[model samples]
Target chain A: MPRPLTIEPNEKTILYTINLKTLFPVRRTLTEIFTRAPRRYVHAVDGISFMIEDGDIFGLAGESGCGKTTTGKTILRLVNPTSGVIGYRPRKQLLDAWRDMGYEPPIIDKFGSIDIAKIPGKYLKPLRREMQMIFQDPYGAFNPRYTVYQILEEPLIIHGIGETREERIDLVAKALEAVKLTPPEEFMHRHPHMLSGGQRQRVGIARALILRPRFIVADEPVSMLDVSIRAEILELMVEVKQRYNLTYLFITHDLAVSRYITNKIAIMYLGRIVEMGDTRRVLDNPLHPYTKALIEAVPDPDPKNRFRIREIPIKGEVPSAIDLPPGCRFHPRCIAFDQHPEIRKYCRTIEPPLIEVEKNHYVSCWLYGTPDEVMKLIKK
Target chain B: MSEVLMRVEGLKTYFYTARGIVKAVDNVSFTLNRGEVLGLAGESGCGKSTTAYSIIRLVPPPGRIVGGRIVFEGQDILKMSSEEYRRKIRWKKISMIFQGAMNALNPVLSIGDQMAEVFMIHKGMSKKEALEESAKLLSMVGIDPKRLRSYPHELSGGMKQRVMIAMALALNPPLVIADEPTTALDVVVQAQVMNVLKKLQKEYKVSIILITHDLSLIAEIADKVAIMYAGKIVEFGTAEHIYLNPQHPYTRGLLASIPRIRGEIKKLEWIPGIPPDLVAPPRGCRFHPRCKYKFEPCDKEEPPMVEVEPGHYVACWLYAKR
Candidate 1:
C-alpha cells in the first residue's frame, strides 16, 4: 500500500533532516613550524559541519573573515576542498563518487564527469541551473546592457526548459510574479539601470528561480536595499521557498537577518564553525563566546531600551585570516577565556571538536568534555 | 540647551541631467543645535547625501543649489566666497568626514602625510609641527603613534577609518558631517568605528550630521532623526519618540522591515511598492502609493509638518489637523 502524504493545517512543514559536514585542513608552512612566518596557514574551515532540513532555512553567521561565505560556497561545490565530505540528498545526481571523495579523483561518469570542483569550464552551464547564487549587490548581478526580460530569459534558454518562444515568455512572467514584481509587463522591457535598487534585486531573484533549482545560496540578498523595502524582498523569498519546496544556504554577517529567514543557524569564527543549532537556541541563548559577542553587537531600535542592552565591547579587530593564532581562534579576544582556565590550556594546545551538547544542539568549546573526571580538572 | 550651530531653510538642490531636472533636495529645512547628533536617515536617492553636499557647497557640475540659506555660526555659508569658505569653514569650522573617506586617502603616502596636508592647508603649520600634531591625533583615536609611518593599505579597514577621523579633527572643526561612516566595515568593525565616533563627539563637543540607511545604527548614535523620502523630510523627532511611536506610514514601514536578532517573525510583511522617482516625484505625498493608512487627502494635497507633541514632528495627512 502506498503511504499518502498528508498536509496538516496550521502545522509547520516537516523538513528532511540533512546534516552536512565539510572538513579541510591547510598544509603547514615553514612559518608555521618556526613560529616566525609572516603569514599563518590557519585552516579557514577546519572540520565544520551542520544540517538544514528541506523546509528549513539555515543561517551561517560570523564576524568578517570568518569563512562563513567559504562554508556556503564549499557546500554548493563552488570551491575545491583539501579533505572531508559533503552530504546532500538531491532530486537528481549530477555529482559522482569521485568528486565526492575529493582531490583529483577520477571522472566516474561516461560523458566526461562534471566534478563540482574540477568540472571543466564548458559543463558549468548545466550545473549552474541546479545551483544558483544571489549576490549581495543587486545592481552588480545583471548585465547593464541587458533588458530585464533578457536577463530573466537567459537562464531559461540555457537550461532549455521551454520549447517555444511563448513558453519561455510565460516562464519569465511567472518568475517575475513569484518575486512580486507584479503585472510583469511593467518591468520586462526595462534595463537594470531603469529599475530602483529594490526592483533590480527582484529581477535578480527572478533570474535565480526561473530554472526552479532545488537549492540556492542567497549571500546577503537584502543588505544593500532600502530600509523600508528589505522586508518586501525577504517576504517574497519566504513565499517562493514554500511554493517551490526549496532549501537555502543563507550566508550573512548580520545576526538579526540570519535569525529572520533561517530556522537553523551556524556561527562561524576565523573560518571554523564555532556552533550550530536551532535558530532560536543559537541566537537567543548562544553557546559559544563568539556567538554571544555577535548577538550583543546588534543595536536595539528602541531608544529607551538602549541602556538596558548588555553590550559586549568587541575589543580589537578580527585577526587576519592569512595569519591566525595558535589557540582557539577566538581565544585572544574572548572575555570568557580567563574564567575557564582548565578549558583554556586544551583550547590553546588543540582545536576543540564539534560535540553535541544536547539534542540537536552542537558546540565546539572545551567546557563540555568527555565523561568522568573532566570536572576534576575544572575543580582544581 | 544650546544655541543652533547651523540652520538650513528652503533648500533645493537640483541636477539638470539630459533626461530631466532631478530634484535631489526639494524644499528641505532643518536646524542642528550645538553639541547635537542629528541623523539624516533615508534610502539611496532619497536626497540625504544631496542635502549634506549642498550645505558644504560641494555640489558638483550640472547640480546647482537653486534656492537655500545656510547659516553656520551666524554667517551665511552659502553666500561666502569660495576662497574664504575654503580657508575658514572647510576642515576648520565645519568639516566633513566623507563616506569612504578612508579610501580617499592617498595609498602611496604615509598616514602622517595625509594628516599633515589637512594641517598645512588649514593652519599653515610647519612640517615638523604637523608631524607632532598628527602623532598626537592618531593616539587620540586609539591608534598607536608608530602607525603614522604606515601607508593607507598597511592598516586594516577599521584603522583607516580611525585615521580619517584623526585627519578630520586635526583642525578642531566644531561640526563634522559623517556620511555613512561605518557602511563599508563589518559588524564588529562597525561597532568599533561607531564607538570611536561617539567617544570623539563627546570629548571634542563637535556636532555631527550623520546620514545613513541603517535605522538601528542611527538609533544608537543620533539624538534626533529626520526621515527623508523622495527628496523631502517626512518625519523628524527624537530617536526614542520615532522608534517607540512612529507617526508616518513610511517610517512605520521602515521599522517593521528590519530583522531583529531577538524577535521571531513567522511571515515578515514588507512595504508593498518602491520609492517614487526623484526626477519626477508624485504630485502629492510621495509615499501615498505604498502607504497603507493613507487617506484621500493624502493623494490630493501634500501635508505640511505638524507638531503632535513637544519635540516630535510628522509630515503626514493622517496626523495633520485639517
Candidate 2:
C-alpha cells in the first residue's frame, strides 16, 4: 500500500538539505488569539540550509537567542525539526553494506541519503551513535551524583560499545587522556564539583568523545571558561578532531573564537544565515550588512583605535524572533535599508535566498541581487 | 598633569576562609587622575573586581580590607567612620556600577522609583522631585524618559545596563566604578553602551574605574591600564604604553592570546597553566610559575614595582634593572 524509501550513493557532500524550519508555538487561548493576537509561532530556526563536509569545522555564529544553539540541537535530533529535510550520508562502509543487502533503508531517499528530519525516534537511536553534542554549560550538563569515571562510562554503556566492564574502563581512560586530562586515575574518583571550570569542560568533552561519533556539535564550548584557558580547550578540540577523524559543528556568539577554530563559518541573524563561507574570506570581506556591522562592533584591542569614534553601522537591538520583520529579517535594523531607498521596496517585499557571490562564498541580501543574478552581478 | 581624584596605596583585601587566607587584592596601588578612565584588566579570580569593591567598601563577608589605605579625594576611606563614610563618601562621592548590574535593578519596582530612591536617600529630595530627576538621568543615557515607568524586565539587556549607568550618575558622583559593565551584552550593544559611557565621561568629566577581563574593551575606554595577576598589579601604565609596548610577561601573553579581526589568522600563543590559588599563592612572585622569563631570583624574592619608561610600571625581575 505504501511506497518504499530508498538511498543510493552520491559521494560528494557529507550532509545536504533544503529548507529546515523549527518553529515553537506560544501557548494562547482561542479567545485571546481571536482578539488582540500577538505572534503565535516563534521561529527558532527559520528555513536555514547549509551542508557540512566530512572533517570540516563548520561554525554557526550569532548573538544570544538567535537560534544558533537550536540549529545545532536540531541536527543532533535533540530538538525535532518542524518541516524540511536533512540528508545525512553515512560512512562508506555502512553505505557499501546497505547496497550489497539490496534493501531500501527506511527514511533514506533514492540517492544514498538518510533523511534525518523524517527518521522516527526508534530509528534515531542507531543514528545517535554517529552524532553527539557537547553542551554550552559544563556545570549544568553533567550529573552531580556521578564521578568523572562513571560519567564518561555512561555513554559507552548506553551504546553497548565495550565487550566487558574492564574494556569500558579502558575506553573511558583513553577518552580522558584524549582530552588531555592526564593521569586519568587522579581525576577518575573526583566529582564534578571538585573540578575547575576548565577541568569540568574537559570532562564534558571526554563524555562526548566516549561515543566516538563521526560528527560533534559543540555549542559555545569555550564561552563559559576563562579567556586564558579558552585557547587550550580550542587547541584540544583541534587535536581531538585530527586524532579521531571527527567533523564538528562549532557554535558560538563570539566571532573571534569562530575565526580561531572554524574552517567554514555561517553568520546567523534572527534564526537565518546571512552569510556563509570560508572563515578567512568571510572575515576579510563580509558581504552582508549585518556581518559588516558585527565585525566593526568588535572592540579592537589596539590602543590607537581608542577614542576614534567609528559610527556603529546598525541601529536598534535585535527584534523579537516571533515578530521578525516581513522580508529581510535584518531589514528593520539594517543600515543599507535606510541608505538605498530604491531597493527598500524589494527588500521589504521579498526574502533573499542564499546566493554564491564568489567562489564558495554565500550572502543573502537583496542589495547583492537575487540568487540567480548574483553570479552575473559579481562577474560584472 | 591633571589633579588626582583617587590614590590607592598598598590596598590589601583578603578573604578569611577555613582553608586559608585568600589574598585577593594584595599590595595593589594605583592613582586615578580626575576625569581619566583607568581600566582594571585581569583574569577571573585575579582580584580586579575585589579591588573595585575595596575602594567602595562593599567586599562581601569573610572578605575584609585587612590592611592598606584607600585614599579618595585626599581622605583615607579605611580611616573614616562607617557613619561618616555612608553619609558623605559612599554614593555621594564614589558610586559603583557592579558586575552584572543590569540584573541588580529591582524587578517589581519601576525604573523611576528605584533610581529616585538614590536621590531621596542621598539628596533628601521629595518623591515627585526624585522621579523628575530620575527621568532626566534616563534621558541623559539616551533612553526614552517615558519608559522610566517600566520595570527592569520590560527593557532589553542594553537598556537595563544604560539604566544602571544613569542610576550610578544620579547623585552626580565625580568618580564611578563600573565592573564589567558590558561583558554580558552583545557586541553591537556593547559598542552602544561604550559610546554612552564615553559620552558621559566627556560631558560630565567623571573619572571611571572600568573593570573588565576584555583587553579590547579596556583599550576603547581606558586612558590608564592596570593588568592584575594573582591579586597583584603586574603591569600599570598608560593605555598606549600597555598596548604598544607591554613590559610584563602576563600582559604580553594576554595581548598575544586575543584573536584579532583583521590580522593574519595565526595560532594564538596561549599562556600555559592556570591562575595561582589565592589561598596559597606561589612564593616570591605569584606569576613566576607561569612567567616565560622566570629566573632564579624570581622564585626567591618578590619583584618591586619598577618604572621602565616614565609612565609605565611593571613588577617583574626582567624590568627590575631597566
TM-score (chain B) for candidate 1 is: 0.97
The residue-by-residue lDDT of candidate 2 on B38-143, one tens digit each, is: 9999899999999998888889989999989988888898998888888888888999997897779999999998999998988899999999999999999999
* Predicted complex 1: DockQ: 0.58
Residue range A1-380, candidate 2, lDDT tens digits: 11111122356556755678899998888887789777488899998888788889999998888999998888878899999778887766544545565534564655467778876665566667788888889999999999999999888877678999899889988998998888998998899998988899999999888877888999999988878788889999999999998999999988988988999999999889889989989988999999999998888788876677656899888899887899888999999999999888868977877777777788888887743465454455
Task: Name the candidate that leads on TM-score.
Answer: 2
Q: What is the lDDT of residue B89 in candidate 2?
A: 86
TM-scores of the candidates are: 0.89, 0.95
Looking at model 2 chain B, report the run of 10 residues with the lowest lDDT sum.
Answer: B259-268
Clashing pairs in 1: A66-A271
Assess each model's interface with DockQ, reporting 2 decimals per model: 0.58, 0.73
How much is A164 displaced in model 2, in angstroms?
Answer: 2.7
lDDT of 1 by residue, A11-113 (tens): 2322121223344445667768688644335456665655455677888888666777777677566765545544444333344322443423343233332
Error in Å for residue B199 of model 2? 1.0
- Enumerate residue pairs that collide in model 2: A6-A109, A7-A112, A8-A111, A8-A112
TM-scores for chain A over all candidates: 0.80, 0.90
TM-score of 2: 0.95
